[model samples]
Target: MIKRLTKHGNSLALVIDRPVLDLLEIDDQTPLSVTTDGKCLIIAPAPDEKRRQSFQSALKKVNKRYGRALKKLAE
Candidate 1:
């Protein structure tokens, strides 16, 4: 979707759509990380360290429990 920045005081702000925010599980309270590669801008929710650790723990357990089956399926 195309978006145009709106004037906000001395700076411009991009208003994100509600549906997109809901899909990304982002809210007003969520921290956003903004970056660019010189050609364009990229905005996204900041990584949650706690969430990352939890996911890693679950992944390790799953690997331990189903590593053989998963590797077999990959073949």
Candidate 2:
């Protein structure tokens, strides 16, 4: 959807749709990451470092327990 930037104090702010925020499971309290690649502007929820570490730890545990079985199944 096309959106226009709204004036906010000395800055222009883009208003995100409620449904879009709901779909992404992000609330006003959620930190946002904004970046651009020369031409296009990208906006998304910032990566949670703690969550990433937790996931990595869980993956290591699972791999240690089932790595051989999983490898055999893949073959």
Candidate 3:
């Protein structure tokens, strides 16, 4: 697919439309990490550190809650 760059101040910006944004599940506030190989540009959603930490915290609690039962089952 071809895309045209629009002017954003002096620099050009590639505008991503709603369909593409919806497909990626990212919105305007979502942060992205951008990089490129010699031939192609790679774009992806950056890790949400806060969300990761919260999920890890929740998982640790679940493990703590069930650790004894899990250990007994293993044995």
Candidate 4:
């Protein structure tokens, strides 16, 4: 889908379509990570650092409880 860039005060903005936003499961306040690879621009949802830390902590606990089993499985 093509979207036109519009002027927003001193900056330009592209209005994201509702359907596209729904498909991406993003809201108006959703954080985004934008970067450029050569001439191509990439946009994606930013990782939730708090959620990530919680997940890492949970993984550590699980590993501690099942370390022997996991090590056996890896063999």
* Residue range 3-75, candidate 3, lDDT tens digits: 9989999999989989999999999888999998979888899988999999999989988999899889999
* TM-scores for candidates 1 onward, in order: 0.71, 0.85, 0.64, 0.77
Q: Per model, how many backbone clashes are there? A: 0, 0, 0, 0
Per-candidate Cα lDDT values, in order, are: 0.96, 0.97, 0.93, 0.91
The residue-by-residue lDDT of candidate 1 on 1-75, one tens digit each, is 988999999999999999999999999999999999999889889999999999999999999999999999999
Q: Give the per-residue lDDT of model 2 (tens digit) for 1-75.
A: 999999999999999999999999999999989999999999899999999999999999999999999999999
Clashing residue pairs, backbone N/CA/C < 3 A, model 4: none
Ranking by lDDT: 2, 1, 3, 4
Candidate 4, residue 10: lDDT: 100
* Backbone clashes counted, model 2: 0
In TM-score terms, which candidate is top? Answer: 2
Task: List candidate 1 segments past 4 Å from native.
Answer: 60-75
Error of 4 at 68 (Å): 1.8
Error of 2 at 5 (Å): 0.6
Compute the lDDT of residue 16 as modeled in candidate 3: 90
In terms of lDDT, the poorest run of 10 residues in model 1 is 39-48
Could you give candidate 4's per-residue lDDT for residues 1-75 as a string of tens digits? Answer: 667899999999888888888999999799999999999778888999999999999999999999999999999
